[model samples]
Target: MELEGDLFSLTNLRNMEIIDINTGAKLGFIKDLKINCEEHKIISIILPSQTFKISLFGKNEDIEIPWDNVKKIGVDVILVDGKNLVEE
Candidate 1:
């Protein structure tokens, strides 16, 4: 049951928190979206890196979750199927 016909605004999406269904961990909120302009579809949703800014790489990396991995988009949260996606 995809949201094929439902209309959604970016603001509405930004307000919803993202959660990983598999691990039941709060991933983060949407910082941006990866959209396919030609196809007029969303490719993925971007989020701030869970790690600190002082990570080994010296900078935090953004997290990109493929649209296909999204299991459901509820009124308050977007559930994603990320198995072993985050530990701790």
Candidate 2:
């Protein structure tokens, strides 16, 4: 299904939650984006920090989600298939 709405700005995407469609798990909020400047396209979405927990340490490895895995963009959350993502 195609999503319909006004174009989303980076600021708008920042406020959205990312969910894994395969397991219905909350991934995390987007912390950064990787763009292919030469191709003028988004390469991946970068998620920082842990999901739903406060880590004792100040850092956890960032999760890099390839753009191809993204399935949908809803009003509140972004749906993605993360089953194939490599575990860090």
lDDT of 1 by residue, 6-88 (tens): 77789999998999988889998999898999999898888888877555867567788888888888878889987634221
TM-score of each: 0.81, 0.81
Which residue pairs show collisions in model 2? none
What lDDT score is found at residue 42 in candidate 2?
90
- Write down the lDDT of every candidate, Cα atoms only: 0.80, 0.82
The clash count of every prediction, one per candidate, is 0, 0
* Alpha carbon deviation, residue 37, candidate 2 (Å): 0.6
Residue 50 deviation, candidate 1, in Å? Answer: 0.5
Instruction: Tell me the spans in candidate 2 whose CA falls farther than 4 Å from its real position.
Output: 49-59
RMSD of each: 3.5, 3.4
Model 2 poorest ten-residue lDDT run: 49-58
